[model samples]
Every structure is written in structure tokens, then in C-alpha cells.
Target chain A: MTDIKTLETASSPEKLNRVVIEPVTRVEGHGKVTLLLDDNNQVQQARLHIVEFRGFEKFIQGRPYWELPVLVQRLCGICPVSHHLAAAKAVDQLVGVDQLTPTAEKVRRLMHYGQTLQSHALHFFHLSSPDLLFGYDDAVAHRNIIGVLQDYPETAKQGVLLRKYGQEVIRLTAGKRIHGTGAIPGGVNKNLNQKEREFLLQDIDQMIEWGKTALELSISLFEKNLPNSRDFATNETNMLSLCREDGGLDIYHGGLRARRPDGSLIIDGIDYRDYEDYIHEQVKPWTYMKFPYLVAQGREEGTYRVGPLARINNCDFIDTPLAEKARLHFRAFADEGLVQSTLAYHWARMIELLHCTEAIRDLLNDPDISGTELITKGNMREKGIGVIEAPRGSLFHHYEIDEGGLVTRANLIVSTTNNNRAMNESIRRVAIDELNGRELTEPLLNQIEVAIRAYDPCLSCATHALGKMPLEVQLVDAEGHTVDRLYKNANGDVSLCKIEA
Target chain B: MIRHFTLDGKKIPFREGQTIMEAAQDAGIYIPHLCYNPEFVPHGSCRVCTVKANGRIVASCTTPATEEMQVENETEELQGNRRELLQMLFVEGNHVCPGCEKSGACQLQAVAYYTGMLAPEFTYFYPMRTVDSSHPDVAIDYNRCILCELCVRASRDEDGKNIFSIDGRGINTHLTVNSASGKLGDTDFDVHDKAAQVCPVGAILPKHEGYNIPIGQRLYDRKPISVVGDVADHQEE
Candidate 1:
């Protein structure tokens, strides 16, 4: 974006300023976007304030090691599978199992593909489609999945059915859709039945076709929104994701890879368990989420973007045949492997969606998917590490167990936190470029939300580290008498006067 | 002699001295209940089975089957109150279901499922409780205990062993063991004790039997808890 260079120096971490937009919708958890405007109406800084405290990291301390896999799944309703697998991977190490029974790994991989597919379908059709199909300047209420149903009825239905299919896959593999405990340490708890496998396979051909169509539609939408993408909140930053041993795209398991904006390699093929050696976490006073930066680039400048765009950029190729074709088309949009258009995330998201379906089809076709030998018994270890490419981005869960097998310490670097700094940068860039001296309309303010939504952040999971412990505010006049007062309830209901107040 | 009463607009027949719960059970109607086992003396501690008898709230397990009495069990108002009580029990203890071995089989969880209780209405207490794994054949996880006192009643009335009792009151109440060492292992409570099989929550579990059945194939898994036992027979009409 032309404004990206000018907005680079706008954010100063020292000072805090106030312009609040609360209850950002269509994404998970409680969050507010705050922008600090200078006297000249120029954007000085912007920040995403995630306020909810889950207390999982703190409360999970004394739980037994075997329980971590199932216990951690409650972190997020939408992305429980990610947490489930990540925690399972970590527990696998704790169980002293280098690898799982073949059937267990295959079943887990199949279940993971379902999770990725379902999440992408939800974002594209249910959340982002309304903004793309109906246009952003449309009425706020009408720019949702319901509006998409009214206009593009078939597309909306397809989105719903696709999500349902993905959910069914999860239910078939795991016990139930939300917080299922099928994925255990060393292996899964059960195997897929032939009847269930047949049922899922029946829809594969149609799902693949729908994936192609949705990806094509998303690419067309991106071209139409290219001007907006180029101008609005285009963040130029480093990229990070997980890649297969041969540098292929891997959503389930792989080695870590980071690339700079100039297509130079920051690090490649690094074991994610050794993440502390190469990555550093920086905390800000304003938000509960932490910013993760590369150790090589240092704090402020080391911030990198993750999720769909980053995954597509950091990987060399997609292993699935049809997905590889889509990847080739996506690569053309980049200039020497550097695509800075923040909006291109939607395009990359579609490619990943295609990849997920193909991956699911491939995993299900493998005969070993239905094999038993689900669990492996082993000696326990004190420390464990697990990492995987979550639908959002790379997720890591590290834990230490006591002699009694109770979890002593747990550290989670969730996907949303990895992109925290980049998300803020996008918001600041958009506010500076678009909101300069203009009366902030609903549509104009929505750009900041749109910029944040592109990351598909799950704030509830990210806010576990530290949170906005109940705050109250009172304004005093020059004479020191109280003029105004504000406070939040336990459920975070602020008695703010309605719009036009 | 046979006597009859009206429950939720249905005629239910009963014998003398039988409580409303017993009559309802005889008539193949399921009234949501816990801590009211037929084999043991009625210990109406869990309040989840409170129903309206003749326009007044009463525990059905203790209320006698009266002639032509109007008893309300499935009213939205009553169910709503039941849901609140269930929610209170959920938050009162550290009931972490995913970590529990008895999650799918727990009657408290099943009752919550039957009452459509999605989440606890109040904040989670996250109480730190001890696990008595000292017993060779049985273990007691105090976190999932709902303080129903069924184990205490079953141990004294059925098992003929005075190993379990209720101690303290109000929020400080807990299950107390009678042995000098205050552990299940030190007591005469065996794996075959009636008290061992009577716990509705995951409080007292048989050792070496964790996750014996996968989640989807458990007791509450096949038919939802609402359709289990007396609850299922009542759904036929």
C-alpha cells in the first residue's frame, strides 16, 4: 500500500491514546479496537485490546498430564480441534512416544483436515462473503450471511452444508463436535467405522467441486477489491508458517519457516520445540495478547504476519494436485514471493480451503484410516512440546509434568497472538490513510474492523496470558470535582449510551 | 389397595406409603431425580427433583402419593428452577468433565443434559479438592462430588459399613471418611460395597476402570440421559 511507508513510523509504543470501538463482531471473544489520533487528525497509533481472561493457563496447572489434551480443547469453540491436536502432540512427547500407531496418526490427520475445511468455509461464506458479495458500503445489518442467503442463496447454502460436512467429519472421528476427547496422547481413542467412512466419502466429489467454485469466486472478488486492498491497511511484514520436510504446505504437522518481506529466508526447517531460541515474545501494557517477534530481527521490526497469507507465502508447494493448481494461481499475485496486500489473505484463505478438502479426500482414501491399535502405552516424561499448523496459523503448546503426572507448568503461544503486532499495524495504516479529517461514518470505521477481521482472531484464547482486570474510570473537572463516571460489570456490559448519543 | 394421583395431566396409580417418585416410577413416568435411589432410604439432599404438589413446591421423593392430587413435574417454571439448581451444583464443585473418567456416565452430567443445561448460570468455583487414590481398588475424586449424600446413605443402609458421612455445613460441607487415617484405603469400604456403585458424580470411581468404554458408547451416549430409565418410559406418551 502507498500509505504503508508513511504509516510505518506512526505507532509509538510509549504513549496510550483513546478512540474506542467495542464489541467487534463476526469474530470470537470480547475485543475493542482503540485508535489514537493526533491534533491534526493523523493516526498516531492503533491497538487491539483483548479483554476477556479465560484463566485456562493458570487453572490447568495442577491437572494430570494425560488430561491436558482433552482439557485444553475448551480454549475456543471454533478452533478446539487445533488446540486438541496441539495438546495431544505435546502429551505424546510426555508419554515418551516418538510416533503414534499408524492408524492413530492417519485418523488424527483426517480429523484435522475436517477442522481446517470447516473453519475456512465458515470464514469465507458465513463471515467474509457478505462483505465481498454485497460490498462493504452496504447497510451494516444486511451485510451478513443472511443477506448472502437473500441474494446468492445457493452459495450461502453451500457454505452451510460444507461447514456441516466438516463438523460431521469431526463428530465421526471425535465423539462430538465441540470439546470432543477422541484425540488422546500417543494416539486417538477410537477408529473410524467403515459405515462412517463410506458416508463421508459419498460427498467428497461434490465438496471438491464446491471448493473449486468458491476459490474462483474469491479470486474474482479479490481482483474487484484490488484498489481497496492496495490502499486500505496493506501491511508489509515478515511471514511465518509450518511446512513439510520437503518445503511443501502442511497444515497438520511440519517444521517451522519464516520469510522476510523481501523474499529472504529468516529461518527454515527449525524444530518448533526449540522456538524459544529463535522467537521472542514482547508484551505491551495495553492488551492481554503478546507480540511474537523473530530473535534475528529484534523486537519491534521482527513482527510477522501468520494465518492464510503467511502459510501460502512461506510454503514452496501444495502436495495435493488440485490444491497445487490453485497455489500456482495464488503465487502469480505475488511479486517475487512478496505479497503485501493484507486483503490477499482472503485469496490465500480460499486456496487453503481447497487444500483442506483435497487433503481430507486423500486421508480418507488411505485404508489405514480405519485401522485400530488406537493407543500406545509408554513410560512418562517430565517435559513435552507439541506444534501444528492451526487453521489460523501455527500453534504451539509446551508443558512440564511433575513426578505425580500433574501439570506443573504450561505455555501456549496461540495463533492469534502471533499476528497481534501485524493486526495493529494494519489498523493504524487504515486509520491514517482513510480517516484523515473526515467525519467518521459507520462504513469508514468498519475499515478498521475489516482490517482486524482479515486475521480471523480468536481473542478469548489469546487473552489467557493476562487480562483486563476489572477497570473503572472517573473524570474530574479542573476544580477536582467528579464530572463523569464509567465502569464495566462482571460480564463486561458497559452502560454506554447508544449510537447518536 | 390402589390409589391414584394426577401428575402433569396423567393418571398415576400407587400403593400405600409410596412416595410420589415411587408412584411415578411405577406408572412408567420419569421424574428427573438424583439422590433418591429406590434401594436406599430417601435422602432428599440434591433438590433437583423438587416438584409442585397441589400448587406447592415439595420433594417428590419424600412426598406421599395422595388421592386425586395435582402434581406438576414438567412445567417450564419447575424445569427452569431445576436447571438453576443443577447449575448451582456444577459451579459449587470443581467438575472438570473432560478430565474426568466418569464424564459420559456421570448422572449429574446426564441430568444436566436432560434438563438442557448448557452452561453453569453462576461463575465456576474452580475448587481445589484432593483425590484419595490411597485405596487399592477404588479412588475418590472430591472435585466432582455434588454433596448428594447418596454414598453416605448407601454405605450405612445397604453396605452395612459406616465408612462415609457428611461433615460441615453450607459451603464448607464435604464427604467425610470414618477411618482414623481419613482415607478410603484405611476403611472397610471395598470395590463391591454398595456405596461404590451409588455415586452419581465422578467422586468415587473404581480403580483401573478409567475410560473402559469410549465416550460415544457410554451409558448416556447411546440414548440421551433424558430417555434413560424412568425418563425414557415417560416420553412414550
Candidate 2:
């Protein structure tokens, strides 16, 4: 860590002349963005590197088939429930159970919605809310969760409570907030008790109102800064998500649906179990993460945006009335075209948050949640694939089991990995548009982060873990001499350091 | 007339040849023991049942219940030592409770909880162990073996199969099958063998039975191990 005195002597917020930026805030896990510049200060190349490596795929081998669901939760702390449920679905196939009992399905769905609600609430209020509530160019010190709590206490309070409510739902359904063993092979192990159902029902209405309030806040903020955000980090890319049989937005279970930037279907109603037939992961030597693209479009053009933006853009309609209305308005705002603005991710996320609340309420009202039937037994299968729309984007869990019921192979394409190329493109656009031929400023550096933050990538879950990831930035001339360097420790404190020639 | 021993300030009546654990069990006092099944001869291999007898730490299951003996079982210092003992047992084996089908029902996990061992303090051994699933009706997951020798005792004394034994000594110590092929499937041991049901952990599991009991409904889920006791203790009159 660079000392305060050394940092003060080297540079300050008012006069940041270095090319590097601070570590990204509000995102899960560690990542780095590098922009290669020419002598003319032109952005030559931009890349988002996943620096951590947790080889979960290799480690999960030889484990019992029944343990897959719980074991996979070790992949991500932010969205363990998503991984848990995905693995559960895959193990369900391994058990040769095509469908879960109504009670089991509803319990799992309720758990997933709670996960989506809490995850989105956390990212919106705690992580990205600070940047949005305070202008992007606001003082770095005052542009964080603490800053939001001090200035917008009511909004922050709602965010905390909404997140708490979601976690409570998870606890009652899944057994714990994180690394829960709720979902098991073939089906869930337990059903929602009447008491648990009522406990969640008590807050459904307030959570819905808060969800709407958050949606409104995001919309107003986006609209207020329409001009600046419209083209900021905007890249017209293809989008992908899971949609119901009737093309309704279904985050938990559905066939794969993908669309071009023009709202034309690239692929629709394809089984996600056959995902490898259409999708291929392209490996680059620079990072641990793999870039996934459509097989037909190839790597460069096939790279698509996912998560809130993609799900909202690709789905025909949202099932919930309130979220459907909001989705319609969102479409109207986009002139019935896909919303290409990166900043619109916040809006789409809140819209889904509202949808999750409605879905949660509906599920709680259903008597099946309290039904006794929880598990289904069937013949065992060899290969199993499970896909779900995680809080970030589409997540896939594929596994192969031996005759004796031990996992032989495991392959996981986490949500963030699907958006790898899109995140790089977002950073590239920001660097080209904002930082070209200019001295590095704190706010300009933050613009690069804001673009990537829109996708809400969990790099830890995507590439895996390695403790703290300190963000570092370096600049070199055409001849590649160390011109300048900046460093941001894990605490998000940025300091300029002189590279001794 | 019954002789008595003072255990943690409580007068525990005992028979002449009874061990402290036997006396404790008879008096409705639960002393956490993994390898001391009352159905077989007691082998104090696992030190989880260590109690202070006359100011000296000793295995309560093997120590004879002497008249006018003073024993301290539930002191804070004893509990802490027991926690350390349980932690060693945890770190020494690949006891992934979440992944194990026997998690909720296993006496090892139950006793660990009763002793307040939330997380292991020692560095994980991560020792490479075997899983013998060749048996049609039973499987042996050596990774979860605690070297308690309950299966060894149960097979020899009750089942009369002599199908299991401990192989290595010290840190390398592990349960070994007595078959020529060194696999449970090759042995004459059946799923109905007393050895099959005697493992304190997930070491010996019946094939095709995976998580039969839901987590909340498992043996120790509703109550701590002290209240429920081990299967042998529960079966004992």
C-alpha cells in the first residue's frame, strides 16, 4: 500500500495525471481493466482480465452425485443460491427426474426469487446506488455506500431492509442465507411451513413498494442524465436470456432465447442442455476467464450482453402485472427497440427486482409451498446439464457421473463468463470516448468502471478466487517505456507511484 | 448395594465391572463416545470421551468406575479440550458434512456440535483417501473414516465376520477391509452386517440410500447429541 504522504506528494483527487484508476467498487470479486494506448494517446486495445483462479471444475470431480448442489455453492458468495439451484437441476437430471414435484419446484423457485431480489437490492443500493445518487463525477470520498447512507438515509434504509427481507426468505426456504442446502438432487428436501409462508407474506407488499421506489429512482436518475448516459459506454451487442414457452420472462426455468441488437431472434426455444451445440467458449491467453459466443456468429460479433439488460431485451413480456407495466414503459422509452444504453442495466435490474417481489408473493400464496411432497425418485442418468438466469445473467452447470454415483466431470460457465466480451467492449468504448488524448482524471477513470459495473459481473464466481485483488494501472509510450503508473489497494484507495526508469 | 462415583458433582451409581461410560449411560448421563458401543467390548480409540478422573485426563470409556471416584466431565476446560479433540478429528479426515449423506444422522457430526466445535482450528490434512463402492449393497468412503474401530469391534464380537481392521498407525492410521482384494465388496460383509451400521461417520454407508432423511428431520437435527445419544446408547435399556 502506498502511504498517504507518498500519495499526497505524487497526486491528489484534483490533479490525477496518471493513466490508472482505482479498484472497482460494488462489484463481486476481483477484476482488472487495461487499456493499451499509442504514442498519440489513442486507445489501441482494451481488455478486462479476470485475475483470480479457483479450479472448482477440477476439484468437484469424484464427489458423490448427491453432493453436487451443495458443493457448487462454494463457487460464489454473492449468488451461491443460484449456483446451488443450478447444480440441483443438473443433479436432478443425473437422478433421471425430468420434473420436480410442485412443492419442491415452488420452494426452489421461491428461493431463487429471494436470491434475485436480495442480489439486485444489494448491487443497486449498496454498490451502484452510491454512484447513481451522487453524480459519477462526484468526489471519490463521497461516492460510496457510506456517502449514500449519510445523504440519502431513507433510500439506503429501504435498500438494507429489502435485502434483509430477501435474505429472510432465503433462510426460511433454503435453511441459510449463503451456502444453503435447500435444493437437493431430484428435488428439494423441505417445503415451506405455513408459519414461514406467513412470515414472508407479511412483507411482500412493502417489498413490492420498495421495489417500485427503487425502479423509479433508477429511471429518474437515468432520465435526468439522459444525454450523458445515452451514449456513455453504449455498444449495440446481441442479447440472451431464458424465456418461458410463451416468451414470458422466466428467470428460473425456460428454453434459451437470444436476439440480435435489432430485436430479431438469433436463437429461440432451444434446449439449454444442448447449449454446447450452439455456444462455444473461446479462450484467450491474457486472462483466466473464457469468452463465450454463439457458434453461428463467431467470437467477435456473437458476443452478447446478458443479465438484467439482456433478459429485459430478449423476453417478449414479463408475467407479473406491475413488472409488465414497467417493462412496457421501458420498451416505449427505447422506441420498441432493445435498450442499448449500458446505464439502463440499473433500470432493468430494478424492474426484475419488482418482478421477483410479485413472483415471491404469488408463490407464497400457492398452497404447494406448504405441501408435504418434496422429492422425486427416478432412474439415474449419465450426463446432466442445468441452466438458470442468475442475478447477473445465464448460468450453466454441466456434469457427468459414473455408474457408482460419483461425479466424473464438471463444467461450469458462470453468468459473468457469458458477458466477458461485452464487459471488455464496454470498457473499450469508455476508454475510447472519454479518455482519448486526455490526462487521466479520477472521474474519467470512474467512467470506465461505471460502464463495466452496469453488467454487475461476479469475477470471483466467473474465474474463481485469490483473496484480495488490488487494481493497478500502467501507461507506456509506443516504444513501451514505463511512462506512469497508479495503484488502488483492496480498500479502494488510489495512489500514483513513480516508476523508476 | 450399589457403589457410587462423583461425576461433575453428581453421584452416579455403578456396578463393579462397569466402565465410567457404562455407568454414565445407566445413570441417564450422556458421555460423548464414538468408539465405545455398549454392544461390543469398549475400545477408546477416539479420545472424545476423555474425562478428568482424580485430576488426570483419562479415557472414560476404558477407565473402570471405582467407588468414591471423583470425575469431572462437563467443565469448561474439559469442553475446550474436547472441542480441540473434535477439531483434530475433523481436520484429520475429509469430513465434508454438507456433501455427506450421513451428515445429519452421523454421531461424529452430532457429537462435534454438542462439543461446540463450529470450525476446525487445525490446518486441514486433506489426506488422500479411498472410496470403495464396488459392493452391491454397501460402500466405504475412507475419506470420512475417523478410525473409531466401532465397525472393527461390531464385526468381530457381534457379527463374527472379522471383516474390518485398522491398518496404519498414527497420522497414517486408516480403516482397512480384511478381504484379499482390500475392498468391502470383496469381503463377506453384507449391508445387514453389524459392522455396516456401526460407523460413527459416513465411512460405511448402505448403497442406494442417499440422504433418505431430510436435514431437519434427521436423528440429531431436532435435538443435540447429548439428548438423543448414540444408536447403541438409545438401544441399551
Top candidate (TM-score): 2
Note the B-chain TM-score for every model. 0.94, 0.95
- Per-residue C-alpha lDDT of model 1 across residues B94-177, encoded as one tens digit per residue: 886766867877788888888889777799888769877667677788888888787888789888898998899889999999
Candidate 2: docking tier: acceptable
Q: Which ten residues in a row are the worst by lDDT in model 2 chain B?
A: B228-237
Fnat of each prediction, in sequence: 0.21, 0.23
What lDDT tens digits, residue by residue, belong to model 1 across residues A325-415? Answer: 8888887877675787888888888898888888888878888898978887777789898998888898989999776566789999999
Give model 2's DockQ, 2 decimals.
0.44
> Which runs of model 1 end up more than 4 angstroms from their true locations?
A1-18, A225-231, A461-501, B1-101, B111-139, B148-165, B177-198, B206-215, B224-237
DockQ of 1: 0.21
Q: Considering every candidate listed, which one attains the maximal lDDT? A: 2
DockQ of each candidate, alpha-carbon based? 0.21, 0.44
Per-candidate local distance difference test: 0.79, 0.83
Misplaced by over 4 Å in model 2 are A1-23, A462-501, B98-105, B207-218, B231-237
Error of 1 at B150 (Å): 5.8
